[model samples]
Target: MSRQVQINKIVGRLVAKKREAVSLTQEDVAGRLNLNTESYGRIERGVTPLTVSRLVKLATLFQCGIDELVLETSTGLTGQAQYIANMLDGVSSSDRDEIVKIVEKICALSHKKHLKSIKPY
Candidate 1:
């Protein structure tokens, strides 16, 4: 497949997964987007090219980042970090500071647990 086609397929799969994760049916998503069920199905199956506006709408509907829908190679913590960054993009500085503090605390706790689990030489 061509590069764009491959990317579409990857994005389609990710979108479908996200939709399912939120317990939304294809018909439900179609209704929300004002699209026909078959047309939305094609987009989910990567048979149709998903338009940029539609993609943005899907991201908004799914409460996720556009990069989560578009970037095929990002996965695991990398993808999650990107998604979190996207969510933080428009937040106030105080909100961002609070979120950073929470994340730092979580990381520090995780690091402590990891260190305890390791048998020191």
Candidate 2:
């Protein structure tokens, strides 16, 4: 399958899994996300693309990170998880590690910047 399709599937499955883990139904998740049931269903099916905003919301609602949702290899997860596992399978270990480091540095820098923006009481 194409990489885009794979990513969508992974993201969709993770969202669905997280939603279910919290005992939330598709309708419940859809309501929280302000999405229609049909649209949300399409997302879970990987028939529609997931937006970054929706990804952030899903991570928050599911108490997970985008990375976790995108790198899962378990079948118990929603279809999205299987897609994530497949996509990650294509990555080189060295490249994955390097990317992780880069992301960590970026997060650290962002945290520092946020701290700098706050004034002392």
Candidate 3:
């Protein structure tokens, strides 16, 4: 399976475990998240992509740091990826998403710069 899929499953299991720890049922979590029970169940099953906004809510609901949700499953991350995750640890998910977009833009610009540096025949 893909790395993303593995990560999603790990995160999902953690979420479900946390919810259980808090003694909340799936219906309770769905209500708090403004999701239907089935949709929330999909998230728990790793069948749905959890949005940053939702993750933020989950962190708040669970009274834990965002890093706590992700850091454990991120054992495979190395160097810069791990650093980036650390930097994003306590940040709001929306801001984190925006930062990712900016990084993507910077990558695009860097690619263009590299192309311009190519020597012409």
Query: Each model's TM-score, in the order given?
Result: 0.64, 0.56, 0.58
Q: Positional deviation of 55 in candidate 2, in angstroms? A: 0.5
Per-candidate Cα RMSD to the true structure, in Å, reads: 3.9, 16.3, 11.7
Worst 10 residues of 3 by lDDT: 68-77
Per-residue alpha-carbon lDDT of model 1 for 1-121, expressed as tens digits? 8987887788889899989988999999999999999999989888888889999999899987787787764569887787787778889999999999999999999999999999989
Q: Which residue pairs overlap in candidate 1's backbone? A: none
CA lDDT scores, all candidates in order: 0.88, 0.80, 0.84
On lDDT, the candidate that comes out on top is: 1
Best by TM-score: 1
What is candidate 1's TM-score against the reference?
0.64
Q: Which has the better lDDT: candidate 1, or candidate 3?
A: 1
Collision count for each candidate, in order: 0, 3, 0
What tens-digit string does per-residue lDDT give for candidate 2 at 27-83? 988999999999999999888988888888888887766766666654565665555
Put the candidates in lDDT order, highest first: 1, 3, 2
Q: Per-residue lDDT tens digits of candidate 3, residues 20-97?
A: 988899999999999999999989888887888999999999887676566554445474687677568889989999
